[model samples]
Target: MKISNETIIEMYEKMVKIRKFETRAMNLFAEGQVGGFVHLYIGEEAVATGACESLRDDDYITSTHRGHGHILAKGGDMKYMMAELFGKETGYCKGKGGSMHIADATKGILGANGIVGAGHNIATGAGLGIQYKGTDQVCACFFGDASTNQSTFHEGLNLASTWKLPVVFICENNGYGISVSQARHQNITDISQRAVSYNIPGITVDGNDVFAVFEAVQEAVARARKGQGPTLIECKTYRWRGHFEGDPTVYRPEGELEQWKKKDPIPRVEKYILDNQVMTQAEMDKLNEKIDALVEEAVDFALASKFPDISSAVEDVYTDIVEEGRSR
Candidate 1:
């Protein structure tokens, strides 16, 4: 898929928004608003932006705990996402799902999974649904490097491959899977190479380059739509924040995190925008200013939003078994 100038600009804006959202959410976490495990996507904006840009609006995507980027790139509402992170009543899950579980099914985002590799099966099922319904919609499941070790990853990959389900298993290899480095966990250097076992094509791309990811994922989506089976894409990316808020990060070696920070996806995309003349610096600045304002408004909306009521703890919990005549 050839990317036009507008698409490039859109990609840049999406990456910028992810960076801003993650940074602001960190501040809210410190302020005691954002709840649960907060995994910021500071250095890995390009992977989500690029891969999602290649997808259609109606396509299905499953996300990881560090999923704010994937959700935002897949067209999730910023205000509602902010509310969810804040655990407010206006959240996507009405203050229940929190950081790791934010989702918007209508936008084709299945959900973000807290359990490692659980989303793989979900995307596989969604792919089967699309196939049964005879739709071109594909499922993109974004997971971590550590999840590649899970049995479900293999099971999901084999199931989709054997059935020829249209699913893209995107492994965002951000070096560490909650403090355990990829080197210590997996013997194979690149997780994409595992695709050989399932007889599916696997490719490792520079996750720092949004264009590279966009091009690679575009081909995979096309192949899936044409009845080709799933492809395992291992994106070599990095994150700037600790796994969660308050993580001591003792597992990280000295100067490693700093080195990855220098390869920030935001600046890389910005440089591409400038070098290609996709947008002038002034226009890019205006775009950033608009995104910043929108992010601020989202934060205010989340702050002003109410928390879910305590009396309704069991209201939606067992709706199926409860009688419909009961009043709120």
Candidate 2:
């Protein structure tokens, strides 16, 4: 299917939002405005934008620790996300979950988990729900390349394939798991090839190219909605920042970060927009200004929101069990 110019504009806006949000997050984390660990989605904007663009609002997605981009791409509210980061009462999780655990059930975002590779389980379960309900809905599972080595990854794929579940496994191959590079940690060069073991379609694409990602995911999502089962898509991209905000990224090879920056997804899309006359530079300028204002408002909202009360720590902990004789 041919992508429309309007969708291209939407993709550009989403990519810019991801970039600006991450940049703001970095500054806020440095100033101690955001508590707890934060994993910035600085360079992998295209993957989330492209994949989520192919999905419907009723479809589900499971996110990782490095998940702000995924949630935002899937229509999460910036005000709520910012508030969550600020540990304020207005947050998505009532300010308790912090950076790694934001969720919006209405948006079909299961949650951004803190544990590595945990999303595989949640996404597979969501796929099961879709199958059981006899619905055409599909689940998109987003994870880092490193998580593919975990038991959950294997188990999720096996079960999804066995049941012919509607799940799309998306691996953002940013080439690092905390300080460890992909070459140093994993044996396989192409993680997508692992899909062969479960008899599913698998493919690798340039994660920086939003169009490539959109096309690939669109096809997979169509297949999934048609009950054709799962597809494993590995997006070869890079993270611009360290694993978390505080860590020194000295483990990265010299000039490596810069080289990846040269392939930065945001600018590439911008160039395409201009080159193809999809939109003029002036229109893009207006779009940037609009995004800038939106981000600023989100920051202001977070700043203005009140912090969560101390007594509310255990409020949403469980559904059925009461806390030490407290009422359910």
Q: Top model by TM-score, which number?
A: 2
lDDT minimum window of 10 residues, candidate 2: 319-328
The positional error of residue 106 in candidate 1, measured at the CA in angstroms, is 0.8
Itemize residue pairs with steric clashes in candidate 1. none
Superposed Cα deviation of residue 292, candidate 1 (Å): 0.9
Worst 10 residues of 1 by lDDT: 319-328
Positional deviation of residue 169's Cα in model 2 after best superposition, in angstroms: 0.1
* Candidate 1 ranges with C-alpha deviation above 4 Å: 322-328
The true-versus-predicted C-alpha distance at residue 236 of model 2, in Å, is 0.2
Per-candidate TM-score against the hidden true structure: 0.96, 0.97
Off by over 4 Å in 2: 320-328
lDDT of 1 by residue, 238-319 (tens): 8878898888899989999888878777788788778988889899899999999999999999999999987545566665
Compose the digit string of candidate 2's lDDT tens values, residues 154-224: 99999999999999999999999999999988999899999999999999999999999999999999999
